[model samples]
Target: MLQDTFNLMPLWAFVAACGVTLVAGFVKGAIGFAMPLVMISGLSIFLDPLVAVAGIVLPIVMSNLLQVMRFSWAEARAALREFWRYIAVICVMILIAAQFVTMIPTQTFYLVLGVPVVILSLIQLVGVRFHISPAWRRPSEWIVGLISGTIGGLTGTWGPPTVLYLIALDTPKAKQMLVQGVVYGLGSVTLFLGHLQSGVLNGVTAPWSAALLIPAFLGMRLGFWMSDRMNPVLFRRATLVVLVVAGVNLVRRGLMG
Candidate 1:
């Protein structure tokens, strides 16, 4: 039963968590990023920190899988071929950094998740653009991948940094979506397996993570519908504003804890 897994969580809290995951999935479907940032930040407010991390893993993996399948297999493969270096580095780092998840203190965990979300969301919201020259693209990809993977391993969120890198390259919208899907989809699988070994995604937490997929999937489908009709730019800006607020609250929690 649900009670056996989330022994301390009440029905109301689980309902709220489903709502949060739904919203997070909607944002991700609309913009192609930020699901984990939204989920981890929102769920942390009510769940144990490790439980929150565990909770996002399956939804993230499944959601990104759906994102990838939206495009043709050929497109996904091309994105993977182009970004192999970055993806490889991220997987390696995620596996390594994940080993420390159970070792970090709770307050440190909050800061690890919060500070980067706040900083990266602010950077994008302010319209700061980073340019990566053709010559430097390869190195930049590896570097960004390393950093993104480390943070992702520790906190279950890494969208901002990866998105920043994509923006830096000035990737076209269509290509960017495929690339994000490829990168995030693979990275999320790594996160799932890494957490499994770290004991964060053990039997009890895994069910809770799996159960969230329903709400996450539904919200994503709705977002896909809205994305076809609305202005993504405006919606993305609004989401970033919310992320800043969420990130700030996370930082406050870390500091005050």
Candidate 2:
């Protein structure tokens, strides 16, 4: 049983997992994405996939909740209204896709996730730019929400498409972060409910989830502290590079599996 296996995991493994969570958390705090992309991909190598996923879920949700709250309710409500259609599409797709998550072969799942992130990172790194105008809003948003939610449901990676869409929107930095936080927090709630229905949230995942919280919170705090000192451009570049590497590794794991 998963519980029996989890109980047998060594102390060092837990410690290492916590360390990784801290690093991933810091990156998440600094950049506002990549927490799951970095942590889950890395931790899965050492821990059970279920445990890894469970460990990161609450931290991601909590962090985003804090971020979303930073904006006034009026601002948040306005943002939600603007993106309501896309959010609705994403939520429905995520609920539908949740059922198939376990059926997906881990290798294939990783490949599907890794390839696009890597490509996107490379494009961004090269200064390739695409802008979304008012004319392109509807179709572009639908596409982004659909793809992002699908991937999020399957692999816990809903960041890339939404990030790309927001980038194209050319929003101000504060608003961009706020929107991303709100979307992620909302998506996390959907995922949590879906996992609960599927029995993915239970005793087996609970201990590790609790254990991971310390590192996750610490990492987030550290990242927040560093954010003011860090150059935005440098932080983005570093994040892109990390994403590219993690994406490649995921592809390799998928192919090997």
Cα error, candidate 2, residue 104 (Å): 1.3
Write down the lDDT of every candidate, Cα atoms only: 0.91, 0.78
Candidate 1 lDDT over 170-223, as tens digits, reads: 999989888999999999999999998999998888999999999999989988
lDDT of 2 by residue, 23-75 (tens): 98898788787787878777877776656666676777776786677689998
- The candidate that achieves the highest lDDT relative to the unseen native structure: 1
The residue-level lDDT of candidate 1 at 150 comes to 99
lDDT of 1 at 18: 97
Error of 2 at 29 (Å): 1.3
* Clash total of candidate 1: 0
Candidate maximizing TM-score: 1
